[model samples]
Target: MPNAELPQAKRQKMANKTIGTHNGTFHCDEALATFVLKQTDEYSDADVVRSRDPAVLDTCDIVVDVGAVYDAEKKRFDHHQRGFTDVHYGLEIIAKRLGTALDDPKVQYVWLKLYRDFIEAIDAIDNGISQYDSDVPARYRSRTDLSSRVATLNPRWNEPTGAQILDARFQDASALTGKEFFQALDYYRDSWLPAADLVKDLITSSKQSADPSGRILVFEQFAPWKEHLFEIEADENVPSVEPNQAIYVLYPDEAGGNWRVQAVPVSPSSFESRKSLPEAWRGIRDDELSKLTGIDGCIFVHASGFIGGNKTKEGALSMAKKALEL
Candidate 1:
């Protein structure tokens, strides 16, 4: 069993800090900010104060989303003021003060990475920035999200916005935001970061084992490779790694007990693959696919030729090897 006393020290340290944000109504940004602060060692156990009173806010060790000030040294992180941009401004200040280099991959990973996965939506909503431009056509619109949920938590129109009511609603808002914040943080820390190493190793090993062209990669197990593949291919600083020669990847399909050969996209976000399956094979399947490709156990090739499958590992490898020749 784990030691019961383990969190006592952390709790004691957290008890000394205070987080202040505005009272009455709440938004996703402040709620998320509160949650992110509590996850850090400096404010894990900090008392949360929801009040707009300047005197109350003045007593807080940190203020977020409510304060007009954007001072990092003073620990005020609000983006509402004129000339204020993204949350990165304040985070960059904190990062520098902590002696983390601006150029460090880990630092860049935290700031730039979380922007997409976690922070960007909050920033966009808070700043009134529309994700899509005005000219973009929309078939439907939706409002079920952190911001809408937080807005719902506020007192109904008939209900009074008293201190007790506001505080209760604030608690609910913080819980919603905190849950998502911790989930995203843990996902990045536990899953995404570790996968980078596995991907790099695969890339290196694949290059070594491939034919002299170094264009094909064979994976023993299926993994999320697109993002890591793009990162590795573009990374020029790595000593032994060559840039962007891979054209396809071969792996096993988990659900069907078959094997897959997928084309490598030029970039992670791009739909255009570097080298798709042969044109003759597209949208063909089963015995016809087998006869056309001269490969046994053939399954199907996607209409776009980006992917194809086979009933055996050897068949998939054969398909990929043949595609390479095309």
Candidate 2:
């Protein structure tokens, strides 16, 4: 079946948060108003009152913009949202990542979004995807709307292997270079941040080579839970809240010596970040860590990078460490 049309409210809701209201100081309610106000630079206070119209968002700088920046002085739009997917998935990943660790109770809500571009892309390749599903066979196939013989694509998903399984679900990704297919993969990947190097960094840092200069110097950047929305899922099996972002300092005993991971603790104060993206990260963690940063824990994995929103503290830190060996 073709993609269903989205209701105006859904579209408006998306625009208000990402695109910003055309004009606004007061939004719909406490949550929405606060959300919009925070997006605007001067109107940081949610209680502050002003206009409430998408048009009034004119004062909003380029940050809240989904498209080109409206240069009032130039009277021309410069710099567009540019693929738009980046911001949509970027924020979504952060939100969902925290969602995985909702048990903390400190985080009220967690959400994720993909812009219209992704919807359009998926539609473009419906035929090819359907054909691939019909032609190929695997351990399992997902059912579509409880239909007959609808092989599930998301059956008992495996961690990083999900991507590889998805690629094989249809045709050879190498031969099928369709924009739709690629967009789907991008969406899939963005949902979870890669956890490759974080393992390497932690493992190597754990080593003590006896060289002071070669030792790891541990530094951590933490943020408060206020600005962030952590989500802890309720699993009859296991329930937990995950950290949205983190940074670890692997300081060895001696300088320049291969510093072992002497200690790994979550920073107490999780501060909001000032970056080019929507999600806020711990200052020290985001700055120092690379795309490979992630942590696995006893009950969850507390990954700093993306892992389809956020991996649990257990899933993030510990599970990710295990994945490094692969």
Candidate 3:
């Protein structure tokens, strides 16, 4: 058989397509990152890399910056729509857009590559030289007596947060280091929320092996939604799925303690693809989502289905089949 039997990652298109994805380097919350991981590969990464560099969002197809949904001062997701901006919720709307784009498989896989860049960036930064210095404030505000009469507004200066702000006035962190640190902020944005490559590798690797029976499939870390124990509480009816549709599955993660799934978004690099998901995912996208929701976040396989060595394609598939039995 032609290499057509290969995984999406090893596909000719994946090799042929060489999109330069941006790195992850912005402030985001866990909800946004968690939301992206469970989605399709292509869409998930597009959103992630953008989290690093949001300027790309406008160029992205599956995900778009529709604007804010809540207010921080108001302390709510939607402060009566009487809001200015809720950075948290604004990102979420964009995340939803990525999920909606799965209707096309081509778009989904393309977005997968973008998501890989995001994951790599996050891993790099989280492990980089940046430190949580308890010596300075994440930012600061001060006013200098520049004029008279109607005192002009003092420009607020921004910088990283750290513990230094608590003491050492002589050092003047602003002049000395010209920076600060925000551990809470960075942790939420990079390490927790963004999509990572490990997830994508699982999806891509599992597709290359043989399945003569075609009755089984392997997923690195898909969240099965159809068998959700709490799904009944949320929605009782289990929707019928398309045969060509890919299955979404969930696994136990030290990061996400609860059930969840991630998807990809559309971006300039992946905008062209909006066709089908991968074969392991049923090779059906675009208009295939309506029936595929049930697979959104389910860990259907039993413990017995799990096989170690997930690094290998065959090994990952073994675990996927084991997950199915659960």
Candidate 4:
């Protein structure tokens, strides 16, 4: 039969593509890889096939985390091959599948953001890389992370290990990962990115008029500022700002109708600040704090000197400026 003469149903069946991965135990990487691929127009309806047979993989339209091949052109994306250190293979595959250039500024931002927030941990676990250099014990243990949650979907050692059984579990794993990935995508795009722009504007304005020292920023409205503060300071496009230059951030306390002066941390992840409020003021409150700092409307300063509150914005700014001089 001539190829064009084939029936519509048979032609449609042939067009339904297959996504291949190794059969047996599944990990977060391949499950996530499969989920990402299925999101694109090209593979939105693709079937998943789990197998170790090269012949079966060759028959599929694309393969991931199997076949010992990492060629993008060939549609194979296994990281187990010798000397393969690219932990972001999933990002590349997604960019290519979406037909969006990786260098596009928006795409680049989301790429790095998602990688930092979500994808990096998965890659690290799959590659057997430790998060810390030393063997120091963690402060606490957490088993509720996405990777850990995915592992719980696998069949128990004592339970059924049939091919159909495993494939069903793989689907569940893919659904679990895909749901979280999309939620993260929505948050970064809808909320976090807008907050970054607002922070940048406020930082620039503060350097111009609000604080001549460029060491204090007063926010009329609060956005999540810590991560954005660090990111803006490190950005090469913004001029005259060194890392950790901004020492204090002042903002209104919506609930108490007071205002707050907060010390920026040494780094976004650290509990320690670049500079703390004066030692004498720490743990002081009310009239004593007002008398000690000579700033009116004083409420309290934290014991650790990371934060203090005042009844007004002017009082908070005065507190921050006084602390800067000390």
lDDT-best of 3 and 4: 4
Q: Lowest-scoring 10 consecutive residues by lDDT in candidate 3? A: 145-154
Please give, for residues 1-326, the per-residue lDDT of candidate 1 as tens digits: 34456597765655578999988778888887887787666777788898888889999999998868987778887778774654634354324433566576665675667678777887778888888768877888777877878888889999888889888888888899878765665566567777787888877777677544657787877878889877777787665556668888888899989999999988888889988999999999999999999999999999999999999988987898999898
- Regions more than 4 Å wrong, model 3: 1-181, 188-190, 193-195, 210-326
Q: Which stretches of candidate 2 lie over 4 Å from their true place?
A: 1-19, 22-55, 59-198, 201-326
The 10-residue segment with the lowest total lDDT in model 1: 88-97
lDDT by candidate, in order shown: 0.80, 0.29, 0.31, 0.85
Which tens-of-lDDT digit does each residue in 1-326 have in candidate 4? 97579998888777899999999988888899899888866788888999999999999999988898887778777877774555434455435533567665656777778888898888788888888898899898998988888888899989978888888999999999998888887677678878988888888788786796679998888889999999888889887777878999988888988999999999888989999999999999999999999989999999999999999999998999989999
TM-score winner: 4
Q: Give Cα distance to truth, residue 191, candidate 4, Å.
A: 1.5
Model 3, span 93-185: residue lDDT tens: 323444434355323433333334333333333234233557677575433311110111111246443323212221232122111112322
True-structure RMSD, every candidate: 6.2, 22.2, 23.1, 2.7
- Native-vs-model 3 lDDT? 0.31
Q: Total clashes, candidate 3?
A: 67
Better of 2 and 4 by lDDT: 4
TM-score of each: 0.84, 0.18, 0.20, 0.90
The order of the candidates by lDDT, greatest first, is: 4, 1, 3, 2
